[model samples]
Target: MQPSDSQLTGVPQTVIIDPNTGLPQNVVIIQQPSSGPKIIGILIIIFGAITVLSEVISLGNTISFGGLFLVLSAVNVIVGVGYIAGGYMIQA
Candidate 1:
């Protein structure tokens, strides 16, 4: 005879018992998520955006590449933010 899957889904049928009080004991380890990767990735993206924007602004009317720089800067910001968000989902 075999137990049904529903029977195994709930509380454990067998548990380790303490000798004195006969209490059920836990056997599994719990883990916590970390957030360091998300923080670092977000910061890198922010710096990249700042770098791109500063160059475009500093170039002023002296060059015709400011528009190009602005577009690339926008891309950097978007990608950086995306990485940060993805990191959080990974932790979840």
Candidate 2:
């Protein structure tokens, strides 16, 4: 799944306004949805692991079934490794 390109929503902070002057006072804006990256990274890692596992299982079938699976497994393993690396990068 992919994250949507949308504005970051933040926790609403209370503001104080003086009656004499009408302007926001002590408005603190908190940015970054702290858990977003971690959650996405975890999901990516899990998917990568699942892909690697399934392809590795298919590796066994190559001896008996043979052919296309061999090439497919090899390609999938590389893609899985790339996914894992990307996940770690995002987490970092």
Go through the candidates in order and give the clash count of each: 0, 0
Q: Could you tell me which 10 consecutive residues in candidate 2 have the lowest summed lDDT?
A: 19-28
Off by over 4 Å in 2: 1-33
Candidate lDDT values, in order = 0.61, 0.82
- Candidate 1 colliding pairs: none
lDDT of 1 by residue, 66-91 (tens): 66776766666566566556555644
lDDT of 2 by residue, 6-58 (tens): 85556898887866567666546699778889889988998999999988776
Model 2: residue 62 alpha-carbon error in angstroms: 2.7
Best by TM-score: 2
What is the lDDT, from 0 to 100, of the residue 43 in candidate 2? 88
Q: Which stretches of candidate 1 lie over 4 Å from their true place?
A: 1-28, 61-92
lDDT of 1 at 25: 70
Q: Least accurate stretch of 10 residues (summed lDDT) in model 1?
A: 83-92
lDDT of 2: 0.82
